[model samples]
Target: MDLTPYVETLRRELAVAAEAGGDDARELAERLTAPLESAARLTMLNVLSAAADEITRELAPGSVDVRLRGLDPDFVVTPPPADSGAATEPAGSVEPPRAPAESDEGGTARVNLRLPAHLKARTEEAAAREGLSVNAWLVRAVSAAVDAGGTQPRTAEKARTVGQSFTGWVR
Candidate 1:
């Protein structure tokens, strides 16, 4: 069946509907509506029936009859494939799993305490001794701490001090 005219009719109707009640589209709706209705009125009922049949066959179960709406009702009956009835359940059932807690920014406090005045001043002195701004100093210190697996700059530096002390002794 030639579905082109019906498809064009639907398209025109949609275009008219899309433009309805808008000032810019007022003329367009008027121009398209008549042609759309004319095409719709000329559509073959058989084509619509065929499209509906194709949709039904795709959706219905393959192993059972699917009855559809009508006066006497239409049905599509499909017998089970030869070995379908003999299928057995697989051995194991999976246990439901627990969902892990969500992680979000700033959810856990990594920075334990604000530096005390003496410690803060020492930190500033340490940065100046290393020729860096406080931010840069902290960044370097953090990198060192992470590399040496410590929480604080002093702990990371302690590892180096201990290493040097061991190497410099008994020379």
Candidate 2:
């Protein structure tokens, strides 16, 4: 009575049936009800500590390399092959998702910058060409650069708000 193969086989069959019903609404709801659910959101380190304990045990120390890896508590897992006789890694093994570790700036990291007066004026003139004030222009410029795949960490919300205030002051 080798139940290992039979029990696992039955488990797989049941999982396939359960999955055919549709997407995991429980998981989706967890993600969708965010900000609202953000308060309940688990940190990745905590999640990794709990969510996939079995898989993490298999990883070597320092194998988990990531920056924004801790940003998402979720990990994606791939299923094992359906062939029963094959000796392979079990299904439901977890893998971490992460952002690239390096940037295109050739390892020169960004620092807080104070704009020089002439450079600021040049930026203001460019903004003027776009019918924007200097601060607004810089915000828009930074946003555009981000949209083009730059990974700046600075928040533009404050800059944009100040720019709008400047708009009023100029009047």
Candidate 3:
């Protein structure tokens, strides 16, 4: 998870490459290494993030996330949900859920959500616990809230005929 080692290796390689060019090249490499260290780390993080997104898509419903802890990037993986019938049924007997046929009903749109760092971390943890990607979790949550007309619990209505049964004989 520590990116320090990788950055250090890159710096060393750069220095070694410069060594062949002469003293001036070596001095330039040394000066640039300090400034380039941050850029190198950022590029590494980007690559890791992209790789995680690709893996997440392949996994679908499950997820792989690259989280940053200080200067390190940590990977968090959530495995696909296990089918209840799989253990009881023979291999290849249970069919995987089919992807919804291409639909024009409504397409997905990206929304840029900015949350406090702590809240973001909590959301990620919750998604991981449910074995879902953060996007999927957020979508489901938003849908439910919209469908229910909000997050508050609905008030129960008073019964109109409580214990009031009338027994009548037809005339």
Candidate 4:
């Protein structure tokens, strides 16, 4: 998304706020424009908007509310309600849910992992050679690893059987 216009709007707002303080404040605000623009470009829009709102509150203390445009209308961005019950936790205090046990079954879950580009390429190559999707190949590999207690040596016979099982299941 093109953030240039949004950055410009923020710069203008800051400049107006600084003008109320005098020449030094205006100059400082002007100097902040480049860094602010960089931050806006690098950050996700919702996060950037939240941060900008916080900064506005700090600077003017309830006199100004900074709201970003172009977000979905249905997406309401508001502060979390103050905790009033045991069931409610303060924002940023809750822990993310732990991953399920490896042996757990039924529903599938998605996980994101960062792999080196070359490693990803090699895995893709191997998956292509096996005529299987990367995800299916990885699932089989992990299942095999667990079943074999991580010590079984890879052999052509085992590989052939694994491939056959996979194709048979697909068919």
Q: Model 2 lDDT vs. the true structure?
A: 0.40
Which residue runs does candidate 1 get wrong by more than 4 Å?
1-113, 151-171
* TM-score-sorted candidate list, best first: 3, 4, 1, 2
RMSD of candidates 1 onward, in order: 26.8, 23.0, 11.9, 16.8
**9 in model 1: Cα distance from truth in Å?**
57
Relative to the unseen true structure, what is the Cα RMSD of model 2? 23.0
Q: What's model 1's overall lDDT?
A: 0.44
**What TM-score does structure 1 among the candidates reach?**
0.24
**Candidate 1 weakest ten by summed lDDT:** 162-171
Give all TM-scores, in the order shown.
Answer: 0.24, 0.22, 0.60, 0.35
Using lDDT, give the best candidate's number: 3
Model 2, range 27-145, lDDT digits (tens) per residue? 44434443433333333244454534334223311122222343343344322213342244335332211212333555312346698999878787765554443433454455455
The total number of steric clashes, by the backbone 3 Å criterion, in model 2 comes to 0
Tens-place lDDT per residue, model 4, 27-57, is: 9998888887767655656565565544433
Clashes of 4: 0
Error of 1 at 49 (Å): 68
In candidate 2, position 108 carries an lDDT of 19
lDDT for position 127 in model 4 = 60
RMSD of 1: 26.8
- In candidate 2, list every pair of residues with a backbone clash: none
